[model samples]
Target: MESLFSTMIVLLLVSLSCFTSSEALKSNKGNITIKWDLISWTPDGYVATVTAYNYQKQRSIPSPGWTMSWSWTSKEVIWSIVGAQTTEQGDCSMYNENMPHSCSSKPTLVDLLPSTPFNQQIANCCKGGVLKPGLESAFQIAVGNAGDSVKTVRMPVNFMFTAPKQQYVCGPTKNVRPTRFITADKRRVTRALMTWNITCVFHKAT
Candidate 1:
């Protein structure tokens, strides 16, 4: 009778362990991460890279999409996107042509693979992503709210990340290995602050 009781206790412990493990997987779903790296500034604008990674364990699949929003605190300066490039180049886009301030797109799809780090370079309002002295002065006057002068301007840029998509198996209802898209927590976003030293030159009061 004692042997039988020991076997029953072992079965009960196994069942509890399985249940706890399943709950842990469910709790890890929205742990995706994104950040800015490799930021180098130019007179025109800065070139930097943004990267996103999947931290979900059970769903271990690449993210379907991610987005970034740009806004600034400088009342005297304006920020714009000159261009951008992604790791999966064609898989992403600044789809909102009307509002290039924000960029959003889905990445290439694959099966049973760790998520690819989505990378992009954000450029300022300079031609060919370069800001020369003369061009820099022009951009300042065009976007700057403060009067033109030989003053040092610091533009603090804020990048807000949002709308992350997680890819996972949809089960037998679709196919042998069907992937589906699910919205993730918008609160899982990250931000970057960049300041540009813009020199504004204006003609003297004649």
Candidate 2:
């Protein structure tokens, strides 16, 4: 009886360890949204691209219960890193280049600024493009030159957001007549959360 009880206790501890590896505690449940940043996926040597995707997690037993991952519309997100572990978010920016990083886990986000300054920062993110989302619409700029063909690129999160207020340039001086995107109930996200993974898909226009 003693040996059996010890074995049960060991099994219970192992089960708990696996469960905690990925934050699935009821208190840790948080909603996450995903959007793509086109040209901006400029990590080194990365190629192929993600067109569309939806995130899903294991809903049953193996106990990744609260864990999840995304399925992309295109298989373009994968890449080959000659010999390095991906060190940053945009490390996998190209279609045929090797992806140095993996999204199999949560994205690394220490670079993300808080809502206020980031909104203000967006005013200067893009130099040559026009944003279509109105003030409601935001744009992402790739770190790579639009014309670079054989180099690897990595995207930075700042590529996904801008601060609503103008400290630098790029902030609009006039209210846009029509907003680019409005929520189902007609509300646009606040300038605060506006950049939370704000996606600006790419169009290689010729």
Candidate 3:
């Protein structure tokens, strides 16, 4: 009777362990994941091209649905937004050949004032649509042209992502208005950020 009781207790413990393991798997099923990559960076006034990939099997996710802010400082030069492009496919047609081929607006080269924090809404940046999984999307920001002055600076950018509130089954031609993306609760959204610096060197012909 003692041996039989011991075996019964062991079986009960094993069953409980399996139940906990199954719960863990169920909780993580069909969850969305985000992957970021610094695709390319050129010191031509430090153009940083970054890419974001959705790793889930479902539909794409919305970006900066909550908040995205960046700031910078430089002693001798000012940072500007010369050109930018955001799309679901990682295409560089607009940013190639040292010219903006397909941007909606011309290169503005807006200045980034010293010690001043800037938000996406104030910058008037275009809002990107849903980015499908297995396919990647990219954002490219070009600063001012490289000059003779030697300078090194860091630009810190932070943003969040969330599922879109409105669901539409339509073609890619749907234009996403920037106003559609209002600032959301930070506590409820997913957050990520990156900071990269650039050092400019001016070389003179001998």
- Which model is ahead, 1 or 3, in terms of lDDT? 3
lDDT of 3 by residue, 128-185 (tens): 4344555544345544432222243333322223344522111111111111123466
In model 3, which runs have C-alpha deviations exceeding 4 angstroms? 1-44, 62-128, 144-151, 166-206
Best by TM-score: 3
Predictions in order: lDDT: 0.30, 0.27, 0.33
What TM-score quantifies how close candidate 3 is to the native fold? 0.31
Clashing pairs in 3: none
Model 2, global lDDT? 0.27
Give the worst 10-residue stretch by lDDT in candidate 3.
Answer: 169-178
Worst 10 residues of 1 by lDDT: 170-179
Query: 1 or 2, which is superior by TM-score?
Result: 1
Sorted by TM-score, highest first, which candidate order results?
Answer: 3, 1, 2
In TM-score terms, candidate 1 sits at 0.27
Better of 1 and 3 by TM-score: 3
Model 3: lDDT equals 0.33
Candidate 1: misplaced stretches above 4 Å? 1-30, 59-64, 75-206
RMSD of each: 22.2, 17.2, 20.6
